[model samples]
Target chain A: MKLRRIQAIAVKEALQIVRDPRSLMIALLVPLMQMVIFGYGVNLDIRHIPLCVLDHENGQQSRNLVARFAASNYFSLRRAAGSDREVAQALDEGDCGIALVIPADFSQRLNDGGRATVQALLDGTDSNTANIAAGYAKSVVAAFSAAAQLDAVQRRGGTLQTQTPVGVEARVWFNEALESRNFIVPGIVALVMAIVGAQLTSLTIAREWERGTMELLVSTPVQPMELMIGKLLPYFAVGLADAAICLGLAVFWFEVPFHGTVATLLFTSSLFLTVVLCIGYLVSVSIRSQVGASQVALLATMLPTTLLSGFSFPIEQMPAAVQAATFLVSARYYVEILKAVFLKGAGVVELAVPILCLALYAAVVVVLAARAFRKTLD
Target chain B: MTPSAPIVEAREVSKRFGALVAVDRLSFAVPPGEIFGLVGPDGAGKTTTMRMLAGVMRPDGGQIVADGVDVLAHPEQAKRHISYMPQRFGLYEDLTVDENIRFYADLFDVPRDVRETRAAAMLAASDMLPFRKRLAGQLSGGMKQKLGLTCALVHTPKVVLLDEPTTGVDPLSRREFWQILYGLRAEGVALVISTAYLDEAERCDRLALLHGGRMVHCDTPAGLKARMPGAMLEVVSPEPRRARDALAGQPGVRGVLLIGIGLHVHVDAAGRSAGIAAALAAAGVPVSEIAEVAPSIEDLFVALLDNAETPA
Candidate 1:
């Protein structure tokens, strides 16, 4: 493989991207747009759930209980229901996600030292949000029960203790606030690199085939490896630039921390970019049409990266078949690396598995792309 | 002109795409400084044969040697000795004419100093210097073809293969394009050009006529014309179609072809023209004039195709 031949192809490709405004926009502006959209638009943290109250007993105790539910930021009181039937109607109409019904004997039973239960109705249509809302309701009720028990102990002339025996303390590492944005922004970097490196590289060779330049190029003394490397160099630069922009936005703009060294981030990103760009070249060489290549790139990179990479959904929670399939997506490993470097402060030694996976992916894809390209020339 | 060793040779070259034989047992030799034309109609496997010789594609069977190098076994090395321009010559529409030329030069590893001088000469010869800064997409069809030829020849390869370089260009551009080709020939470069136009075949030193992926005839234009089966007599009639019908399958008449405003009937002997005229006249088809004439390349091709279709 001659360096001059590779340089010639690289220079020509760079000129094409620069001269064509559409390609430039795809390489630069699209990533920025995706950063803003994915950073703010898709929030998994559900809030401001509407609540309806059906208070049959209009007593102070019932009102106090209603205020407790209203105080928390997670639930907003939409309206009051006249009866149980009205509460059921509200839940059925989808007007409120949570409904609290206080029984008529709630105040009497509590004054007599007898236990009283309030029925909490919840809508389970959107199961993810509904499950979170249910968890919040259970916590509130548990806190109220503990407070009542403490009052009973204090009135009996005994000291009340707030701490329970054998209490478990849960601490979240890296993301103290558990802000989804901190986790999501890093994954977005992997996604952006995949699109810029693979999608753009996929179109390069296919465009040459469409324009009839491949025949002319093949007729020269240039080898297949030279052509593949030359075509990948420019797009790899674009992918790196896109990764940098996303990382910058995630760190400064979105306030996500970058705990690892810059070298580690660059190294991992380079390996991932190589893998994706080789996949793009393979698709272009096999399909040999611009339209077909673009479609294949979109399907092969974007959808799988977003859905199957455990970016938004945890791989552990996915079905076994899906968990096994995630191994096939290069972004899955890259996402792990990005999250590790940006949030966990992990170095190469601590993150060897993902690094090895990415390197292996890069090596295999490059070999396959070279072989496919040689076949195409023949 | 003195004969020289063959710069390009193909032995029993064949290509198959599944069930279809694109090129069947094709063989040809092109000497240095000669223009060899591959003449055929659409789907006649002209492109396939040219591709195999240029080393862009390998033949399914046979040997292709270019400049003493076996192209099939060592295509990359063989590529240095030849240049190929496909029907669509892969010009970068986004790049300027000068940029396009420089790119090919760089790919071919032409020295910087040599590229500068050679590119200047090519642009000057093709009258493209004024439009060097223009984008390739903005150039006229003819100018694009000229630029393609210039880029292909910038490295000064020993052989050049052009596939239908003048298919869609206007008549004037076509003439100018051929003039540049002649200039290359004068520089001792071997050219293998495929064209559908028989008139272009007349310009080559020797031409091969392909039909249905098989070579039917290969000879110089004059030699192929000399191989016409029988004497041709031009018949001018007020109703030429009626006269062709009257002469069809007539005794001593080998074939009847309708040329514009007349019919050229091939008779087995020159003495049989009077019998043909008498036969047409007896069939109530009046002939204004009749005379023996020499056969054109078109006439010979038509006759060859007729013979191929209905074999004796």
Candidate 2:
């Protein structure tokens, strides 16, 4: 209950963080680097699609098709070859994103007023990019059909008419621009909290146990609950500080919108951090050695946060069993909470489920940590 | 010397960690302002007993009372009367010396003015004044141990438990550390210290010899020495290794330990030194000189362990 005691402990802990540059790098520098990499590395909207053209027929129709592909910004003509094998090799080597082949019978079919199908091959290594490439290729073919019809109408001089087609409208919610930064920065904030908060608490408590300092503290008039709360406070501050920096960068630097209240964002992130720190303390108290504590802490935080947390993958899209397992990942709900607050500007009523889940996680972890800590020094 | 009542007492206390019974039915009491020594080697449960008495751990069986307060029942209340410095006495290596002391003082809720002056006096007594501004981690091993002791006693507890505070310290630092403990004893503080060095145990007002989770003996150093059935003999010879081999398990010879080139043999104090000389001479081992010596704590410990056939 004494502020001075907590302050003393917090000051010591913060000094340790300042003294160790490697921890600072992991806590601060890495978040920024991740912000930039995840911003660009994880894009769903593919641009400057590469396509190899194989035109076996030296006719006007084939030339015109190649021109259409080159004229559009979506497809960049990488290489023009006479053999299908060459274009396939380009796709195999990842030199081109897609390949277009116009056969030798393309001019004969066009002259005979018959439909000639041109082959398009796309690489599906990156499913997102491959999907975008497929859509763009279809649109290019549609545009080519409309241009050919219009040219036919001009040649026939009002006898033939090119008629209308269907139109579609698109609207995006949450992130209208769908900038990957908006999606990734929030997740990076959660990840940073997990890594930094877990490591700080693990080292602080485990080192005390190893060095025999906890015995002194236990022998004092300090209550176990007081000690646990005091230790958890400083690390909670560190996690909150890192989250603030991440949020600031996401908003000002990356231009990601923060539609929700800052207090709500801070409070939700603090709950996630509390859960992480409690897990770290539990690991520290259970294991006597710092190395052992660190290994357990890293595995405990990283596995759940990365795989089951729905950070990179959507839980809804996963298997039913995986979706069921996501409930066990404390950070999964927190990541959702972060996105909702930062991107969607969700209010407390709208995010009640995730908030409640986080509160439950925090309570369970804190109780377990206190119990483990009570028996550690002995 | 009105025989002050026992300030700390443990009756039939026992603790077992899985298959290992670390403290077995150990009972000891430390009167006020006395230095009680718990002497044992590694894994001998010295730390376990200290932890129990310090109220950091509850004994699996039996009761521990510090100043009439049940250690297990009201541990936090009992802890207010004691300070415990474990084997690797914890120090905040990153913080300045002043900060480490202040942190402990704050934990114990020491008032501002009293804590400030007490900390200053403690640092001065331990000869750590000039180093108050230095980082604890950067201090030498001995200095760090002293700093740990200072921090432990900053709140002026009635009893202090030190778990081998000088195990790895040099002989000079060990002497200085004992001097500090003696000073604290003079201030009416009950001091319970655990150590592996039998020689250090000689300085205690009373010693508790522990071996294999059991107390072998508890008495004053001289009293334990008086219990030894034989007198320790220092035997000098040109061939000590050969002398030890020849004297091994010989009649009337209880123990033979190598001290440099000479072998210290324990024998009957009533007998003449000539008997051992003659015994070694008849066994074809050369003996230069033999003299009867007083039994040290080490000698008493060796004799007791040998008599009990327990692994020392």
The TM-score values for the models, in the order shown, are 0.93, 0.88
Query: Going through the candidates in order, what fraction of the true interface contacts does each contain?
Result: 0.87, 0.79
Question: iRMS for model 2?
Answer: 2.1
Q: Quote model 2's TM-score.
A: 0.88
Q: B1-312, model 2: which lDDT tens digit per residue?
A: 345788889899999999999999999889888999998778889999998998878889999988779988988788877888988757778788998888888888889898889888878776789999999999988988988888888888888999989877877777778888998889888899998888888999999988888998899998988888857888888888888888877777777888775888987555747777877898888777787778777778878777766453
Docking tier of model 1: it is medium
- Chain A: TM-score in each candidate? 0.94, 0.87
For model 1, how does the per-residue alpha-carbon lDDT over A54-148 read when each residue is reduced to its tens digit? 99998988887788889987899998999878888999999999999889999888777799899888999998889999999888777776776
Residue B110's lDDT within candidate 2 is 88
Tens digits of per-residue lDDT for model 2, A203-299: 7777877766676666777665666787777667767777777778878887778899988987888888889998888888788789999998889
- Window of ten residues with lowest summed lDDT in model 1 chain A: A369-378
* lDDT of each residue in B61-147, candidate 1, tens digit only: 999999889998988888897988989857898999989998999889999889889889878877888999999999999899989
Q: How close is candidate 1 to the true structure, as a TM-score?
A: 0.93
